[model samples]
Target: MIPQSALAIVALFASLVLLVMGNSSLGTIAALRLEIEGYEPGAIGIVLALTSLGFVLGSLFGIRIVQRVGHIRAFAVFAGIAAVAALSHPLHVSIPGWMLFRLVLGFCIAGLMLVTESWINSHATPQSRGSLLATYMVLFFLAASSGQFIVALGDPGMYGLFVIAAIFIILSLVPISLTRSTPPQMKRGKRLAFSVLWARSELGLGGAAVSGVVLGAFGIVGPVYGYEMGLTVEEIAVFMGISILAAMVVQWPMGYLSDYLPRRLVIVCVTGAAVGMALFTAAFGQRSSMHLYGGVALFYALAACIYPLSLALTHDMLAKHQIVPASSLLLLANGLGAVAGPAIGGAAITLLGPSGLFLFLAAALGLLLLLALHSFASERAPLVREQSHCVGIAPVSTAVIIDLDPRQESG
Candidate 1:
């Protein structure tokens, strides 16, 4: 039987899975709905970009919210706001109004993730935290991927899908809110500069930021891109799910490899593979439909590997207490890149066409590959420390990971 702490972790993740599913489904729905409503591509891009920005602010500020109200209260409040925001889509029809709701949704989702993760972190023994984190990564991808199918259940122009997203959030409130386990004692990290993080692990920081660029564009607008490419509704859904599932398959293996190999070497190989796949996807997209989907799946798989590898690499370098600060710094880098990626992709699509999305991906992956190569050239380590077991996590997680690091383990 699982311990109480382990049980709590399960309850939290179960709730989070639904929450993520609702949000991921909404991303696809929003893109389709905006297009159906006749919004410009640039305005659609701004909405997506604003959502990412809201998430950034929430991740930064969520610690205080948790620390102040405790996890259950925070979770309840955040989930409530998120649900209301989801339902707001049908209540009002203005693009600007929906933009406001998207920002609120992003902020609430970020807060909920931090609250839940902090609870998991506080409960987990270091011996188990690695697997726990990996479980989180797998569940979120699976949940998010499954959510894409919701599109087929109803047209985006209808109110049903929006209400369904709201329903998922409300359902998510059931698990952890009912749990008898204690909430984690949460706190903020000491701020660190980019220079400090780069010195700690150049490839980790750079790769995380680049991963954001690719993932942000893919998550926010990939469905729209697929539709513009003349894919059927069914094809668009499959393409998104296939890309997500492909990423899920490789996350653990890549994380395991990073445990033994030089972390930068793993980053280089993974990013390089993604770069090739992204370029192939762009070119093949014109000539063969089958090849385009295949290339997209593989490209996403390799690109998704970076988030975990980058986190593992960062863990390999930080002192026990410094983990939170490092995670925050790295999260910030990812957020900044995510904020930029969609606008850049939007511009590419505006200037070039739908295929421009793939070009943007390739260019981003190429930049990450270059960063890894530069790190390999520097050979700048002062001393190697004993490595911790690697943990896989999604990009949405915040800085509370310090508690899960084995180095910080205590009786």
Candidate 2:
């Protein structure tokens, strides 16, 4: 039987799953549509990069809207805007118009996540927080992965998929609007400056930024790469979906390993593995779908571990009270990297073709591996007691989600 605490947040979780599914499908569909419309790789990259820019902006400021209007009302407002953004894409097919719409989608999606995560965190007790967070992460990844298959439902060039996406976005407001839970009281927390955070853990900050670059680039360009390589929309859906699912597959083992080993060492190993997979994909991904899919899956499986490992590494060096602010700063770094990723990725694709995507990933992961090795050599390793247990966290999250981490100390 579900605990009362778990049952209490069922409405929020339902809304979260719906929101992610709709937003994820919209992103994949947008990229595929641009490729089909014959947009240049650079142009497509810029358009997609704008979405990340909006996300960064929202992460910085969207919380104020929530604090002002309250959670449920804020959720409804964000959802309404997101639904409009989804429909806007098909209605206005110009690059500028689509860019505007994608930006709005990103901002609103970030806002929605902020409200949902903060609400859930507020209601969580120390006893229930761990299980609730574990459930939340599972649902988040599953919805995102499954949402990719929605692209297979209709032509990317048509209105059907966009309309369906809009419907999903609008429908997400239902549970939240009906929920009886009162809004959580918002509190202002002191933020750790990036310069200070970097001083404490350069490897952590660097790893997070690079992880965002990798994830952001792949999210925007992976579908286009598949489309360019002669994949059917359905095949592209399967390829991307499996790659995302593969990210979740490796998290637990990676997190467990980091708990025992030096996190920098684990990071170096994972980064090294990701680099190898990236090279494999670049070399053979175009020739065989099996190689392409398998290589991409392994690449993400290893690459996605970097953020969580970096977070754990940072936690090792900070006081327990500092965890929340440090996480926000790290996420800010990740957001900045995400803003740059698509442009870098698009430039590579323009020069090297579809396989260039993996090459860029290889280069980024290679840089991160070198940094991890350097940090491992320079810094004294933390004792086991000083280290925090690793938790699998998504880089796209708002800082409020950090409160749900079991590593956080009770007030």
Candidate 3:
């Protein structure tokens, strides 16, 4: 049986799963649709990159809306906006028009995530926070992975998929709107500057940026790559879905290994493995379906852990109070990298073809490996006498969710 605490927050989790499923389906559909529309890879890259820009802007400023209007109202507003944005894709087919809609969708989705995460954080006891966060991470990946299958529901070239996406977004409003619990008050906290965070742990910040670049680029362009490789819509869905599920499978084991070994050493090993997987995909991915799916899954499984491991590494060097604020700066660094990822990934695909995507990933992770090696050698000694245990966190999230981390003080 579920604990009362868990039972109490069922509405928030239900709402989150619905919102993410809709948004995730829309993201995959956008890439597939654009490919069918005859747009150049470079143009699609630019259009998709704008969504990251909007996400960064929303994470930074959307909190003000939450503060002013309260969580329940803010969620409704964001969800309403998101549903409309998803519907708008079917109505407007031009590049510029879709770009505008993508931006709006990104902004509103970030706001929706912000409200839900913050509400969950507020209600959590320190003892239960870790369990809750772990559950949240698992559900998040499941919803996102399952969402890929939603692409098979209708043809990308037609209006049916977009309508289905909008319906999912609109349906998300039902659970939260009907909940009886009072909303939690939003807390204002001091945020660390990037300069301060970098000075404290360059490897942590650098690793996050690199993780963002690799993950963000793949998220936007992987579907296009699959489509280019002559996969059907169902095949592409399985390819993307399995990759996300692989990340969820690998995170805990990787996090556990970091707890026993030197975190920096674990990071170096993971980065090295990621580089190898990226190269493997570049060389053999298009040769066969099994090779392609397996290589991509292994590559993503390694790449996804970097952000959370970086967070754990950074936490090792800071006081308890500093961890929350520092996380925001780390996220900002990641977001900036995400904003640039699509442009670079697209250009590579344009110049080198579908294989260019994996080649680029290999190069990026190789650089991060060098940085990790240097940091490990230079520091030599551990940053703290007792290193913090790693936690699984989604890289694309608002600062509010940082409060839910079990490492933070309950007060």
Candidate 4:
């Protein structure tokens, strides 16, 4: 019999392909919308903002849908919707049509992501949970990074972007369709326990909240920021690609470091570094396109690991049973933060200029860092003894790793 871990690895890999396709396709469109459709920056911001909003809504509903229909069916349904929506981008040709499509696309992606993450979380045992989650995170980061690189393959004007996206999204569907492993049975769907979860471990709650905001900013405004800075579509894509790459490369180290160090300390340092980088980049202002790419890459790399580092820390603080509630709380925090991050970032760019993007992000990170430090200081409990043998985490299950609460349930 094939091992569950191997199946999970396959599922996560598949999800990565879809992630690249979905995110990259959107990235390319964002970069090209101004030139191709002649939309104003504000309109562009609205489209991106709506998409983030759709994702937040999707996460809430996806859990219920998956509960009823099962993971595999839900995956196919959403993936198919995403594929069709992506293809339809070329058909609309109008800005309003495109906006509607983007919102649909956003909603569809949320379903796909939630279903995938839930599947993974359901199957993983505490013994191997860390490794499993870490591996899945690594693949996710890599795919997200590579999606941006797809822009370099061809012009956004041609059908190439849509086709590329379709290919990735379609490919993402395969492993789950073929796998024989049964997805874990859902008990009740995850619900927000915000106050309790936050009170239990401020670091975990704060981490989820900050990550959502950071992701929203990066997803919604990252491309737009590059466009405003005079980067060509190709360069903008490459710049985003580089940022994701930095995140991908840094994840494993961050994960292992979390295992060995105090998680709150690690989070503080990462958040502080992110704040510093954003401030420096905003102040420095890229002289040339190349400079922007390099700076953005560095900034992304520094900031991207915050989520995983926070995840590791959350796990460290809680008892085994507490993980589920903690994970659910984190997801809620992330959704709320994600919604706020982009709109605020976009408004900053509109009001203050492109550098305002970084300025806004820096402010957000500054708050996160302060919270992390404060959380650490207030907790006076003795550190748990380091276990000689850490838990062995399996690969992510396609059913639940992408979009649901990171853990399906608490106790």
Which pairs clash (backbone N, Cα, C closer than 3 Å) in model 2?
A: none
Report the lDDT tens digits of candidate 2 across residue range 1-411: 866555659988998888888988988899989988899777788898888888888877898998898888888899999898899897888898988998888899899999889888988888877887888888988999989999999999999999888888888899888877778987777878888899999999999999999999998888888888899999999998999899988888989988888888889999999999999999999788889999999998888889999999999989887898999888888888887888898878988898898899999989999999999899988986567899999656888898999888533
Sliding window of 10 residues with minimal summed lDDT for model 2 = 1-10
lDDT of 4: 0.68
Q: Which stretches of candidate 4 lie above 4 Å from their native place?
A: 1-12, 34-36, 93-96, 118-131, 189-192, 288-291, 381-399, 402-411
lDDT of 4 by residue, 268-379 (tens): 8888888887887787767665556666777777676776566556666666565655665566567677767777887788888889889988988888888888887888
lDDT of 3: 0.88
TM-score winner, 2 or 4:
2
Candidate 3 structure quality by residue, lDDT tens digits, 38-127 = 887777878888888889888988989999998888988999998888888878888889889988888998899998888788778878
What candidate 2 gets wrong by more than 4 Å, as runs, is: 1-5
* TM-score of each prediction: 0.92, 0.97, 0.97, 0.84
On a 0 to 1 TM-score scale, where does candidate 2 land against the true structure?
0.97
Higher-ranked by TM-score: 3 or 4? 3
Cα lDDT tens digits for candidate 1, 113-154: 888777777777758866676677778889989988877778
Clashes of 1: 0
Question: Where does candidate 3 clash, by residue pair?
Answer: none
